[model samples]
Target chain A: MIEIDNLSKKFGDLTAVDSISMNINEGEVFGFLGPNGAGKTTTVRMLCTLISKTSGNARISGYNIGDKDDSLKIRKIIGLVPDNVGLSEHLSAYDNLEFFARVHDLSKTERKERIQYFLEMLGLWDKRNVSVGTFSKGMKQKLAIARALIHDPQVLFLDEPTANLDPEAAKTVRDFILDLKKQKKTIFLNTHNLDEAQRICDRIGILNTKLVSIGTPKDLEDAVRVRKTVIELEQVTDSVLKSVQKLSLPNLDVEGNTITFDTIDSGSKNWPIVEAIVHAGGHVNIVKVVGSTLEDVYLKLVGENQ
Target chain B: MKLSKAWLVAARDFKIFKHQKNMLYGLVIFPVIISIIPSAILNYAVNRDPPLPAAGIPPILDAFSIFLIIGSAFVPLGIAGYTIVGEKVEKSLEPLLAGPLTDGEILLGKTISAVLPALIAMYTGGVIFMVGTDAVSYPSLNYYYFPNWTIAVILFLGMPAATIMSVEFGVIVSSRVNDVRSATNFGALMFFPFLIIYILGQTKLITLDTETMAKISVILLVIDVVLFFISTALFKREEILTKWK
Candidate 1:
């Protein structure tokens, strides 16, 4: 579990992370979401004790990050995967893991077994002997994950784990996260990928200058009250646009050729607008009922904070 | 676990050195080249018309000692320069910092690790030059090439002090500077004092006799102790990593 209270990290006039407070329970996959420079990485850095907080406090696995006595315990309990994959590029995948295994104090047998298992699990067994410099970006990421998990840490702090991965590689990382969840490992994931957050995270926190919102995806959507109704017409004529606009959606915006409207009524659907567009000599090309995505809520919250 | 982890980092650096042996020339070969320069000068002096005063230990040792002093500057610049900056370059520093090791521990590990190989190589070269010079030029080996307490003081006290000072300065430079090369070049400035001392000793302008060497060793050892604590204190995790310049 992780607890942060009014934690603020400032670099001169720039406040990287402002008085942000949140709690992540054990076994929860908490997604820390934000845009670039939105303080997601800074918060994780503070939690991992890589950078000290200018104000307030954070406790990881019941050990206060600011406390010297509990520093080692906190480090032992957390596995961190930074946004950039930093490995001993000259060392083979196996050697890198072996080295970290020793640092983590795993016995020879345990180290070998865990290294083999994680390498095989990450599909890196065959390439174990090759220097990491020879591996692709995805392979390096997988290796980084394996290194992080080598110590069997209680909490995993991942900063943009799959930022630049191909879809397949991203899915592999996702599957690995799910596997960690099965092992009851708590994950503190910092990511800007809203869809990934929605899919993999149990709860999410939107961070701008600070912790702006924290909830499940649905809870965030509800809090922001974003509706998902697809409106399609044969021709997006003036009359059709006027009629669609008159649908009285509270928060509405035009995105390209499509008009997305956020309505207050939970039961109100896009059918009436479709009918109105058709009556106005426009055909509904695409119509589907959807819900507010994590992105919608994230942008809204970030906008409000700004 | 901490000690082992420190060694692990050290070993990893060594392995990486082996892989990219060429890049290590600045550290590994520079010391040898520095030693060889003095050896070459001594070789010429022995063969010259007016022979240099006190050939073997006096002249060659002076050159070798100066080599060490200058080489000490480069060792820290090489090791400490690359320690943090290399991580930043390869983007591995964050994860390393995330480990349980404190800044002092990490620096200690890296400092000892980087210093050992360079120092060992230089010491071997120095000994070989001493023996080689004794064999070729000396009428007898006993008096000219004896292993005196001065030699011990130079190796144990003088060398380590210079090494630590270089590493400390290098770390401070690396923290503030963005580029590793720039940090290293800037850090190399620490060698100027040692170079000046070496030149003065060589020209007989400053007497670097056995007694003077011992005195300098003690003085340098005290300086090293002070600098070590200062470097550790200035290396505040909150200050360098989180704070802005």
Candidate 2:
């Protein structure tokens, strides 16, 4: 449903978003994982037609982002929940949704039904009349989501939807997004919360100015292959340290009497290191090989790119 | 531009304005005070011990009418400030800009939102000021002095042009600043040109006649058109989301 080709955005000498390309299919939850100033928001802005891309091109539902006529058409099919939520403080939650509903030219009856449906679904129906200024951060975030969905757009762009919410609030937003995923919505989610990204996204892309890696969560984890073996010895001697260093494993570290290093294939590679320690007159207290996680892959990719 | 989309934006701002105590008070109080203060002063002057000379009333009345135009110019600054800068501070423009509306449509909507209320309030106060001025000056001058061509030109033409200028000024000022108070303060500078015209009118350097007021109206309209372009440029989503700080 979304096609981007060689997209890059620059502000004078600084490039906010660099050349990157990806396609998001219908009903696919694509998570953009990046740190601060990683151009996640910039990419979303370009796709949502809120900002212009300095170079390259993008299209949503076959409507060009660079074309004025097509930009409006693209906007009609997309709903965005920015990182800030950006809810009107003075307007009531109900009025906020109603105004957006009317902006899309929904009839009065359709407006009423959709507003109530989204509100009830988001668990905000009881507080519809309350001023948004008085709402909690999670409540305001939920209301923003409702406002974006008031017109029932086919594609949704969410930038850091659960950045600052409490655990329960974040879970609520994640659950709501998962429900949308079930409804076959094309969702482009930008987030730094690894767990949230892993839980909600079907496919994930790690970005740092440029698109570093893109794949399923399990696929990304499998690519990193960062099973680490950590051994606690009774005493550390130069011979024992030399014995492990002779292996030249990746990411080697020594903290007090413990030795740690990345194992290529922990099933076959971990035993030699344990035997090496024993031969070097080091008593092994405990030996454990830990599997890699999404964070490991994320940090490895982001750290490598940085 | 889709006017329905514009109206939706305006209606939303208007609904929120209804809930704002400061905006509501500014709407009612400025008009009432502008209408009453001049009428009271004129009445007190006419009832003075010397029974202020009837012959001198014409210039004073002509000059006093400019206050209505000035008052109308000043009124929209607060509303414009709140509507434009309030959104910037709250960061709510992203969602609105993310919709199908164009930049021109959003700017037009905001302009209408600021202009409609100021016109209604100022025009209502204009009527009251006319009636009250007539009540005080009719006996002194031996005739109803209002509803004349000059006052009509000032009210219908000059007032709208000035109000539009104020709103456009608010837009330009809003882009520079992140808060409403700062926007309004900078917007207060917009009235200096109107104040200069009023002072010139009082000094008889420029007559406050129909022809002069009409010319002023056209000049202000030209400025409004120019400022409208600048405001539209500044209000673009890219400039706002990136350049505005």
Candidate 3:
């Protein structure tokens, strides 16, 4: 549903979004993961036509993002939930949805039915008449999502929809998004929460100014070349940590008697570590090698980009 | 531009204005205050000992009537400021810009929101001012000095032009300013030129008569057109989403 090729945006000397290219299919939930200043929001803004791209081409549902007439058509077919929610505090929740619905030229009946349907579905029907200023952050965030979907656009671009919400509230939003996914809505989700991305996204792109990597959760985890090994010592002395540090093993993490490090070659690396621990008078308890996770892949890719 | 989309924007703003007590009060009260204070001064002078000369009343009535136009220009600064900057501060403007509407349509909608209430208030105030001045000055002048060409010219021609200029100026100023107070204060600068003309007319440096006022109205209309283009250029979706502070 969304096609982007070499998209870039520069603010004078600073390039907010570098040459990034990817495709998102219809009825797919594509998640964009990145750190602050990583161009995730910039990419979303350029695609949504809220801001112009400095270079490159993008199309939404076969409509060009750069063309004037097609820009409107692209906008008509897509809905955006901005990072800040951007709801009118003075207006009631229902009024907020109705205003956007009217902007999209929805009929009176369509507006009423959609507003009621979304509000009720999102558990905001009880607060429909209340001013948004009085709503909780979760409620306001839900309302923003409803406002975006009021016209029933084909594709939805969500920028950090669950950023600052409480865990429960975030879960509510996640569940609602899952519901949208079930309905086969094409969703482009930009998020900072790694777990959310892993749980919700069909395919995730780890971005840092450039497209560092893109794959499904398992595929990304499998992309990491090195496995991690944890040596559970019966009693870790300061000398054991010092001995392991002397070797300068990658990603060495120690918690009490347990030490974990990235292992590229298990037989060669583990024997040396066991010798170091035994020489330091620490008894071997448990040694295990574990596969990498999405966090590990994300950190490795984003860290490499940085 | 699709005017229906513009109207949707204006209609939403009107609904929001119902909750803004300050904007509503400012909209209603400025014209009322300008209308009454001038009439009060005229009434006080007419009933005084010498009863203020009959010939002196018409020029004074014309001078007082010009306040309607000045008030017309000043009244919408608040509404215009609130409508544009309020959205900016709330960050709600992004979704609107992200919608299918064009830059021209949204700006036109805001212009309508600012112009409609201002014209209504000023026109209503003009009515009250003309009736009050006629009631008080009639005994001395032996005629209703109002309902004349000069005041009509000011009301129908000069006032609308002034209002449109103020609104467009507000939109331009709002692009650079983040808050409503700053927007309104800076937006008020557009009327300074009109105020200077008002001062010139009061000092007899320029005539406040029908022909001169009509000429000034045309000039104001021209300025309005020029500012409209500039304001639209400044109101770009990209500029607004990216650069507006």
- Best of the candidates, TM-score: 2
Candidate 1 clashes between residue pairs 3 or more apart in a chain or in different chains: A234-A283
Question: Which regions of candidate 2 fall more than 4 Å away from where they truly are?
Answer: A233-252, A276-285
Model 3 stretches astray by more than 4 angstroms: A236-256, A264-282
> Could you arrange the candidates by lDDT from highest to lowest?
2, 3, 1
User: C-alpha displacement of A194 in model 3, angstroms?
Assistant: 1.0
Candidate 1 Cα lDDT to native: 0.76
Clashing pairs in 2: none
- Looking at candidate 3, what is the lDDT of residue B141? 79
lDDT of all predictions: 0.76, 0.90, 0.89
lDDT of 3: 0.89
TM-score for model 2? 0.96
- TM score of chain A per candidate: 0.87, 0.92, 0.88
Model 2, A1-306: lDDT tens per residue?
A: 999899999999999889999999999999999999999999999999888989999989899998888999988889999989998898888999988888888999999999989888877899899899999888888889888888889899999999999998888888888999999888999999999899999999999999999999999999987888889999889999998889887899999999888777546768878898899999999988888899999999999999
Question: In what order do the candidates fall by DockQ, top score first?
Answer: 3, 2, 1
